[model samples]
Target: MYVLIVGAGQVGKMIASNLEDSHDVAVVDRDSETAEDLTYEYDVLSVEGDGTELETLREAGLEKADLVVASTDSDETNIVVCGTAKTASDAFTIARVRRRTLLNTWEGTQGAFGVDFMVCTDLLVAQTIFRISGFPRAQDVETFAGGLVRMAEFEIGPQSPLVGERVEDVDEYDSMTFAGVFRGDEMIVARGDTVFCADDRIVVIGSPTSVKEFAMANVPETTSSAEDVVVVGGSEIGYQAAREFEAHGFEPRLIERDHDRARELAEALPKTFVMESDATDTEFLDREHIDEADIVIAALESDEKNLLVSLLARRVGVDRTVAIIENTEYTDLFETVGVDVAINPREETAEEIVRFTRTNQTEKIAMLEHDRAEVIEVELGPDSALTGRRIADSAADLPDCVVIGAISRRGDLVTPRGTTVLEAGDHVVLFVDAAVLDEVSTVL
Candidate 1:
């Protein structure tokens, strides 16, 4: 497929990087240096011009493009780019925005801005934070097969009970599969003899019940529920996160230094406690007993402030700390320095936008460990390579890095095993190394 990406920013560059390996990609940016940099960085056509202009779109070969993505930092510019692209071509248009209001408006009126699909960065980050908050020690979480199958990534803390247990011995959960493990920079495919270690990010996929049971077992001391949640900052992402918790029946507390913004948030969020105070103030933190909270989320606009808040929360005895990181490079550093999880809004937005580039056979996608691997849900067609073969036999013909995580047949969860046979119409979720993603897609 030929893809034309507008705005060559972080999200656009990521989307280009993910697709340039499989499709024909062209990027349009107003900055000559950025366009030149992208041209030399990846095997893509880089056009220097305004994306919303018709002449620029023509120069970028939009006439023959299969997809057009508008991913500028400005929400209005992205919307206009998509709308403008629609006037000249029939390519599938995707716009990335930071405002929930724009997404709601586009949803209420489908294709309102000539955008075939829209992704809200703040909203996606908020939802991701909310999902991670549900399971203790989970670095990332995603659901597949209509919530029947779940995939979770948990970091083994220094004191975790499964520190030295072998994968085979930890197979107590009948329906769960040990998909893979991320140890430092190495991606180890899980096996019977694979032993758990401290700080290892283990990815598991299975029935929801099994996943939940595994989470509870992994952290026996931490309660399964996140009751007392605290959000620092009044940014859109922070406010949306507090709203998400409130919608789920948790009256979270939000701290914003700006009195006007705090009042606005308090008015908008009925169940959330919005306090006007500096989150760094130790006296205020102690007076409110913030140390007793189950989780403290640092969503301030500044990366340094979020890091400071996360470290302070940890110092104050909060069970977990989730920080919003604006810089992609700071993700690993923040986690290494003590933040439980560091989420990049642009990364989340890029992942969501790239999901649309998958083949029609793919139903959903979840990128893990910063695109090192991917867990994808695919429906087997009548002509699929594995439709009539047992998984054990099919394994010989498939890539070594791929693992059949779970299967949903007739709305029932089916745990994958070597003896299990795959049939047409089965929704199979598989964990695959990103390096072989294209090859795996071709076969299944």
Candidate 2:
């Protein structure tokens, strides 16, 4: 596929980097330095010019491109670039917009402007934080179809009553199903006899009500309330997180290196305690009693700094440590270094745009990962041939590229075994590698 990306900022660079390995990619930026940097670092063609200009876009071969992504920091620039691309070419266009206030209006107005999709960064980040804060016990929550269904991840603790319980013996709670269990490094397809234990990360899928019931039933009763949250860094994202935490009845403390920014944050959030000091400094963190924090979030702009501070918080016995990482390349490394959660605002925003772009098609993607993998939840079409077939009978016909994790039918979620049957109207969640998306689509 030929793809043209308008912007050389962090978000544009990430999208280019992710797609460059498999697609013909070109990046456009008004700043020559940024364009040169992208060209030097990746295998993408870089064009230095105004992407919204028809002449510049034509020179970049936008007419022949399969996809055009407008990711500049300015929402106006992105909108204009995408509109121009859609007018000049038959390409799929995606535009990135930062303000949440513009999102509802844009969704209704973009079609007239020739925009294929609109991505709102502020809303995406806010939604991610909101979902995570709502379910403090889950390490991650990926919603599908406007929150109609969700996939939540939780780590089993030693005190969890569900530990060591077989799948079959566990009572179904609010129509939820265990999707898959990540035992150490391997992701296992859950079975009836599979037993959950401490340290195992389990993925469960269901409606919001059922998921909450499942968490209430399986998680330890000793789970602490979200009373104290320490946010390290006073960047925009950090400030937003602090505001959100405060809104949710949490006493938040915002730590920053710059004295001016710290004072400003303190003034803006009178309920939150603000400390002026380097977040990476152990002495400062210790003085602030970091160990007493229920959740410690390292929201520094730099990924390395965030990772280091999060690791230190972990070593000092913080209950949960989350790091805000700008660069998606460092995501795996942050996870390896024991960061409980790594949030990438740019990547998250891009994902929302991609999901919005695909809403018109039958490819109902639920969650997208930065690593080129997608988890899709699609209802079995009534005319589909696989309906009413048993899992054992349909094994050979099912696409080898897709893995069915769970099935929901008649308000009951079932962890399908070999004998489990698939009925029409059943919503099946499948984790698919990007390489075989077409094959999976054909099979479905």
Candidate 3:
């Protein structure tokens, strides 16, 4: 597939980077220097001109492109680029929008603006922070299909009451089901006989209310308490994260280099403590007592700055360190550097765009990356051929591209063995290489 990307900014660059390995990508920006730099670095085709102009888009070979993504910082520019692409090439167009009001009623604007999908970075970031904040004990919360279903991650600490329980006997609230558990580097799709041990990272999936009830019932109360968190950076994303933490009863201390921005954020978020300080300075971190904080989030726009701050926080023995890394190229490096969580705004935005674009085929619940593969969720239709077939029989009929992760039928989530049968109303989750998505879709 060929894709044309507008803006060449962090979000556009990220989309291009993620797609370039398998798709022919072209990037356009008004700034010639930025376009040249990205092209030189990523080997992507660069078109230096205003993306809003029809001529500039034409020069970028939009006619042959399968998709056009407008990811410029300006919302107006994004809308214009999408409109022009739709008119010129009739290609699938996705526009990046930040305003909350626009996203609240995006369905009304979809056809009028000639946009196939609206990627709301603000809402995506806000929703992500909000979900994680709701369950402070969970490492992450990923919801699918408007919160009808959810996947939550919780680490088994020493104090967790579920440390030595069998899977079937484990006590949980009525509506929740344990989907899987990750020990060290292996992921075990838990069966009835599997046992839970200390320090196991478990993934649970169920209805939103049921999952929350289950967590509260099974986990200790102290585990979910948000006492204190230190956030390094005053970027928009940082402010959003801090706001979320504050909303969840966490005391947030924000550190930023710019005094004026710090003061502005302080005024905007009265509950949060805003301090003007360099995040990478270890002495300053020590003086601020960052080691005492329960969580440290490095949301600096620069990947290098976020990484440095995260490393310092980790060295100080902060329990959890999350860094917002704009560059997708450094994702692996950040993991190797010991950052607890690396938040890539661009990749997150791209994932949202892709999800919106492909909403018809599959409901993307969460994206998990392994050694060299990705796992995604797709709901099965009652009419689907794979339904009602046993795992062994379905495995032979399924295209070589997809591997069934688990099947959620009725309210029970089962890790399918050879004899386990899939039902007509089941929701099947799959782990597959992203390259074969098309082939996998046909089988479903």
Which model scores highest in lDDT?
1
lDDT of each: 0.93, 0.74, 0.73
Q: Write the per-residue lDDT of candidate 3 for residues 33-145, one digit (tens) a residue.
A: 99889877886899999998989988999889888999988888888899888887878888898775565566765475788888777557755755765565665678654
Worst 10 residues of 2 by lDDT: 354-363
Each prediction's TM-score against the native?
Answer: 0.98, 0.74, 0.70
* lDDT ranking of the models: 1, 2, 3
Question: What does the lDDT read for residue 224 in candidate 3?
Answer: 51
Pairs that collide, model 2: none
Model 1 lDDT vs. the true structure? Answer: 0.93
Flag regions of model 3 displaced more than 4 Å.
Answer: 1-4, 7-50, 56-67, 73-76, 86-92, 97-116, 129-141, 145-227, 246-251, 276-289, 356-359, 399-403, 406-425
Cα lDDT, model 1, residue 136? 77
For model 1, which pairs clash?
none
In the range 1-444, model 1's lDDT, one tens digit per residue, is 999999888999999999999999999999999999997899999999999998999999999999999999999999999899999999999999999999999999977999999999999999999988887778899989998998999887778888999999888888999999999999988988999998889999998778889988885465777899999999999999999999889999999999899999999999998999999998899999999999999999999999999998888889999999989999989988999899999999999989889999999999999899999999999999999899999998779999899999999999999999999999999999999999998899
Q: Residue 398 error for model 3, in Å? A: 2.9
